[model samples]
Target: MTRPTALSVALSLSLPLAAHAAPDAAVVPDTTRDIDRVQVTATRTERAVSDVAATVDVIDREQMDRHLVQDLKDLVRYEPGLSVTSSATRFGLNGIRIRGLQGNRVRIQTDGIAMPTSFDIGAFSNANRNFTDLDTLKRVEIVRGPASSLYGSDALGGVVAFVTKDPADYLKDGKDSYVGLKFGYDGQWKGLLGGATGAFGGEHWSGLVNVNHRQGQETVNKGDVRVDNDRRTAPNPQDRDGRSVLAKLVYAPSDTQRFRLTAERNEDTTDTDVLSAISTAVPTPRAPLTSGMKAHDTQDRTRLSLAHEIDALDQPFADSLYWQVYTQNSQTRQQTDEKRTDGSRRHRVFSFDQRAYGLQAQLNKAFTTGSVDHALTYGFEGTRTEIRQKRDGYQVSSTGVVSTTVTPDAFPVRDFPITTTTELGLYAQDEMRLAGGKLSLVPGVRVDRYELKPDVDSIFAQDNPGLAVAQLKKTSVSPKLGMVWRFADQWSLFAGYAHGFRSPPYNDVNIGLTNVAFGYTAIANPDLKPETSDGYELGLRFIAPAAYVSLSGYYNDYKDFIESNVNTGRNAQGLIVFQSQNIADARIYGAEMKAGVEFGELSPALKGWALRSAVAWSRGDNRTDDEPLDSVDPLRGTLGLSYDADAWGVELAGTFVQRKKRLPPPAVQTNPNAPAASVYQPAGYGVLDLMAHWNFAPGATFNVGVFNLADKRYIEWSAITPGLITDRTLSDRFSSPGRTLSASLAVSW
Candidate 1:
């Protein structure tokens, strides 16, 4: 039998099979019929999904509960164009990946406040961006392309905005008091989750409090090898725990004026047995280097904010106003313990911390002049952030003699000096309606000024004898234009052009390191440039009472991409040198389609039946080196069928992914004695999932899901690394989980 390809399945599903369908009961709702849904992240103001020129996706509280969502991976399970990066050895998720970019390029925020940036050092320490709890969120919005025109720096790739629930959400329908409780279990991680919420409201005030906790073990995989060595494919043993708290208060003096205050905290801890690092090889057969390893990691975040809103004002400058002031603090600490085969021990500790304070405000006005209608919006944002990082280690012999100076590095060293960054931005946008509201035009622009100042202290000076830290100050302007034309009753065409950029980070600009014993060193660079991109998108949409379809294409060009720790030959002292540089130019293009229909439109007997499908394809190239970019994912698609009734619903979904075919050629070995370079290319695979929900009682619901029904052993392309090709024995370590089950129950009063 011939296997089906990604292109074939995508093209076949893009056709309309029936007319008008309900939302998927188990997964995300069909986008075709969600035209009336309101989203605010795309334009910084409330707008219907159909009116936005850019591609956007929304996940609400109802969807999250039905899907039994747990983490970032489960959040994007049905999204083809987005993914989460992870490490097999580290045993944790890194962050969200949008398009072909990940890490610091994509911006993540909660309640209009930015999250902490991710940072990594070698293989022992990694500070990730998984700081928010899913249970505390009411809605999540994702913008696909460049959004820097409105959000400023760090939005060069895209934006993810998380909106937390308010006291009013639970005190609706004239309820004076409310309470909710929830419990859940996940088979893959053997985890148990519990949460509780309470809310109270009166004539003039409202308040709410929520708390959630989870405890779990290592995630299960298909690998069965139990040997303790580098060739072992099974996941290392681990124990993890997490907790979060959210509280809010609101005061309303009148129908047009309101004030809100919020507080939140999240903490997570993990302990892992690093069996993958256990090896018996060393300088010679007589002396082995490592025998065993263990690690403990912790992360925490806290936030406080106050906001005010006023609407229906008669002022000349604005009809509505919203403003907020917030402060956030986050930290990460990691410790690694290693035992040498020759009766020696080593320990290392790494820490990273950040503090931020910011304020944001926006005003909106609507008026008419002559034959044109205008809706204008303007906003300003200012922020200040301070960052600090440190690493400490010690080595001891069998006789209990400890030393701070190890073989490769010294103890308590700073990778970069204490740095502070300040930024201020001003932006405005106008939406003009012309030709009797058939044509809409939007023009927006923003100007931002940023400054980075470094404080070199005694610790940094002692580590690097004679190094100079660089200070950066620059101003940037971003502009965007968008148009929507409705030529017919049910057809619309939209197009957009945007400019985006990301400022240079502290670690990349002034990194300092020395390894005299290993004959190598990495120095700082002061001439790094900010990365920039220009993006364009065009799309067409057809919306009818029975069916909905959308097709879009996009292209993006990037310049001055920064590549860190690049080898730049030897220094004057004959030591190998490395530095960060801006050297790459690239381009990425893609196409996507979404279509859905309801079987009920065809016949009354088929009522409550629906089908939804979507497909995405993309390609990227590194123009500077004339090679294919490996960060780009392969083609992918999803299809779902569901049946809904008054009290119960069920759905069966399938996810298909194509094999990775585009890769750069292997590097040539300049020295005959060096190892050869290679790449890992994953094979195409498809998986099926089944989900069901039942509303057995009033204000109570239960959801259950069975994923990977066939128990197929497969590896996600995003988890595969190029270094894995050199050691085939460790290939199974990257394999995804087998069949798993998840169930949850919630009750409200």
Candidate 2:
């Protein structure tokens, strides 16, 4: 990645207003001093985090400014239940696991729009863009646990929503302007610059626009032997450049009615070279060299929203109506070369492109049951996603001979074809208050109709005739129940039980016979059952006048969990490669707690300061097989203390992660020659961080920080070493950037 040269800056400045206002908002002035309360979209409706029915974590602008958090991974340390794993390249698109569940189970959104690009096989890798870049953000909200009833598919684990900054949120009296810049060195060169502006009539309308760019060089590890040849501190060779533009517009005719439109685009390019150690039967050990892996990815999104609140309805059954529509387009391409000492060489080129469109409308009604308040929420949501890929396979022998196995696949491969999935969901949730607000019962149900269509599936016709001749469709209904009892202002208890389901991905539901008519071995199964799970949870929330405490515990039981399996227990060329099948029951139980105190409560000397800490302990096991779940961390926690004065603020924080015990893959028809085993176990480690913020002037500020104070070595997960005979090595490991330093400056008027 290259730095933003003067030529690039001039080009950006020369763009016309039409190009800059592609989305919907306008740049307003004086936007930094308004709206102390932050609203989140965790639910269809807007509400404060503390009032939400579920556990929610809010990452505010102040924190983003203080930490210079440029991406999702940077924010993970502050979130109690969120964890991210990824390579050094920001283009690698980190994976987020919430409460031990990973992959497509979690729902990610921008504002109220759904981002459903996790359809490609490599989509889990470096095929998608991360939801970061602070120039266009207002705040972020994370909701933990099954949210299927509200979000539909892909919400089996949890939901993360990136709420873009609205012109109104940043503007003061609906008028504000601001510019922010960040510069840092993390054993490597890193820099960032961005700005935003807000302008609008106090109560009628508002608009905003923002742009930012970031660049950084690769980093190395200290005394790390995993990648033998790459002796540099940051051997994984990486360079990145990203630029984004966002615009928003809103109209509010009255306090009860509002309309909004938003648009954003992000373009980024990345280059990375990967090297790993390998030893074979040869005299001298040879390490595989992965050279010239380059990728370019882009994301564009647009949304339109409308909301209205009414107190004049003839009946008490209706209180508000809201409607929203959003669309997203993302494209990613990766070109790679692999070389090994065994004389085996391969050239791989692949591109993943996806488009998703969704629409949702909801009605919220309030009424009285006995002397208690009852609210009913009902909504309809529809989503359509299309995934397309183009990839070529190549192989070359040690004799300097090269052959092409296959060229780039067309729009739709004949065997697997292009898959399109569409879903329609109808759901309703009821929240009833009893015993003078001391007890509340919330129950929800969602019915979803899903249809997966493949353009062509000739290879699957031999086993199931329905696949090649036409298309297939599947659907399921999910339900949820929960209750909360508020004993006092400082003490509250809650419990919940929810049922969720997941349909097999189109590429993994093969069910066929011997190689035959379709020239392929396996077929597609139209009758596959949806994977299901039931979960029970209990929690407590205690908030005193000057302190806060939160605790939660949950037990989850799963049935028909999808696991990878080989159809015929034999590997033959041109065979239907893999299928998703039901596996034995699994259970996960864990506890999480976070507490904080206001220094002012202890004594006057400790005024203007605060202290906070959090810890989470989780364990998952396949009860039927008596084995731990892969990638499940046994223990994790964070401790932090901060102080603030009229002119400055400072904070110190530390994080700890315990080792992970490896486990086998989901399932198989029968055990193979070698049973699956653990390759590496990551040892526990800790690091400290420091941050300081100073208000230099009425509208000027500066922030400085140090990350990875100890430069400790650690690993997040394990990966396999590439070679003729693949070995294993832990990934996402490093000797922490060796005490990096960062600083930021900002001005607003």
Candidate 3:
């Protein structure tokens, strides 16, 4: 089959098909007709989404299948105001930026449990954002703005919530048991993926299980044609494997009460050259030389949770209640061996392990007084986190001479110490239905108490007494208020104001540093203040049987912004080190719009046709630094037209991005051989994508995608930043994947 040009594809809207979204193998899920039907996260209660005052975009299962994302970064491709920083290919430290904030500012929750973050030394990668498997997710929701009223800390920017699949979602009222299997492949990665799912039920009990595995595949990038061709070394090219398994059981002794137990495990491992880049172009007398860099990275996790729920029950003043207790453990280890070409040999090993346990309970009650009906919800959540970081190795001279002092075994070699973090939050929210259900008034408040403590080894204490001292504690109170006014049966106006806060993470406060080779020493800070944010948004929505539209704008003001590093300079070893501190303030603002129309409703002859579009624009100002925020995403827009038939469908989508001209000059250059301090700014571009599906038989389906149909090679701004580099290659940006084809097939009975 031949693909059309980007222009021709962009003009294919009149061709007719499933116009709402891409089809998965020949089927467009019927459930999508109920886009605004129901949601629980918005108000912590099961209610029609149209009644909520917040903006929540739910990526349903069908949509997930269409994207076929292999990692978390791919999930934001078609969405607006969401982008991931690609970092260098070597450490591959990538992160997602929502609106204008990322890192700790954005909270990642899996089934309501907070996930952990990852940070590495030499490679400079944040492996934290790539763990979750798409096969395990039933739906993903992006909630923009500070959600401190509901989730407390790590919610200054917003929240990304992941909900796993449930057997009940695929079961029928009379079905007792069912089994299914699926297999998929992508051209870019050249890999095979397979999974199995099963469910069985009885009068009082039911169970579900899903197991998925991706053997191994290396993601291929577009051919080299960027400003920086190959200045720095990239990670051992993409060889990796991953697996995920989940099991859930539900028991109901009566109609109104039930209990559920769920267990999940995920694992990923990679063995490749950690640092294979070498540049002899620079004058080498003062430069440290290396024979080669090789490493092995392995990350894994296991989680168990038990929950209880009660529906409209025989209670006094309460209507319902929900509670859960969960525990999770995860680890990331990297071992790299290096040989100096100059004659000296340097070897290193590092590991990060975290254990977390938490409890959550929520109570809901509905009552009416006079003209207003009230739905009140109260909840309390707590999490205790323990982290252990270890690093060991010996330094060597530039030449094959003598190996310097070996890394101490008894002393703490980690950037951070043995640490413990505990966070407790108590919150309550009330939804008032007034004016005969034409208006909703929501008021909520949350109180949070947090503490961080660390233990230092004698080796650390003897070298840095002030940095090895003790603990940090903080308390925060957050309030939220929102209102919605219904002017017409199908139109509503809403507005909200919320307060958010974030505390320093363990790594930033106490990354232990003792490098005698280069002569550098860093200490932990026991007294760091929290960062605070105030946000405001106003929006209008129009919903009807044939169409939907939403427009909104938001502004956020932050105080005492906690910058990860305030002072940067070379240590005794000549290695760069940073000390943490707070800045005066910062601000970000943005606007968003979404609209969809069903052409079938306008004309009978155009049945099964529709069109959809979404656009986002945002900007950030780091006032304290007097510069534009590099993390802020550029203006983006997506336009799509689709045709849906009973057993087949096709979709054509186009995404356009505006170039970013706002940027700060490069960092201050210190060492002569070190990378030149400069910024990686990207130019904007547009691309087109094509997808089609066919249901060949009863339970069989076929789907295909012509990615980058125009064969245009574009660069993602997030993927180019060097992220504190020691070498400068002058690469302006990271080029995305080139033209590729992808298809998948599945069957079940």
Across residues 1-749, which tens digit of lDDT does each residue of candidate 1 receive?
00122222222222000000111221123323445566788777777778888888777777777778889888888888888888886648888878888888998999888899999766676899999999988777888888888888999989988787777777666789989998999888888999999999998798989999999998888888878867678988889999999998989898787788989999999999988788745644455467888999999999998988888676899988888898999999999898887688888888999999998988889999998999998889999999999988898987899998655567788888999999899989898899999999999999989889999988888988887789988788999998989889999999999999888888978887766655666677778888899999999988776677778999999988887767788888887777777888999899988777788887889888888788889998989889888778899999989888878889899999999888877544446887665677778889999999988998788999998999998888777654345565667888889999999998889
- Sorting all predicted structures by lDDT, with the top scorer first, yields 1, 3, 2
Instruction: List, residue by residue over 657-683, the lDDT tens digit for candidate 2.
Output: 776554444332123776554345556
- Per-residue accuracy of model 3 over 359-414 as CA lDDT, tens digit each: 98888888899999998988889999998876556666654454434432223355
What are the runs in model 1 whose C-alpha is more than 4 Å off? Answer: 1-35, 282-288, 667-677
Against the true structure, candidate 1 reaches a TM-score of 0.94
- How many backbone clashes does every candidate have? 3, 26, 32
The residue pairs in collision within model 1 are 20-546, 20-598, 21-598
- Which candidate number has the best lDDT? 1
User: lDDT of candidate 3 vs native?
Assistant: 0.71
Which residues of candidate 2, in runs, are more than 4 Å off? 1-53, 88-91, 119-126, 129-134, 174-193, 219-234, 275-317, 337-347, 393-415, 457-470, 510-523, 565-567, 570-577, 661-678, 718-736
Candidate lDDT values, in order: 0.82, 0.59, 0.71
Best by TM-score: 1
lDDT of 3 at 654: 88
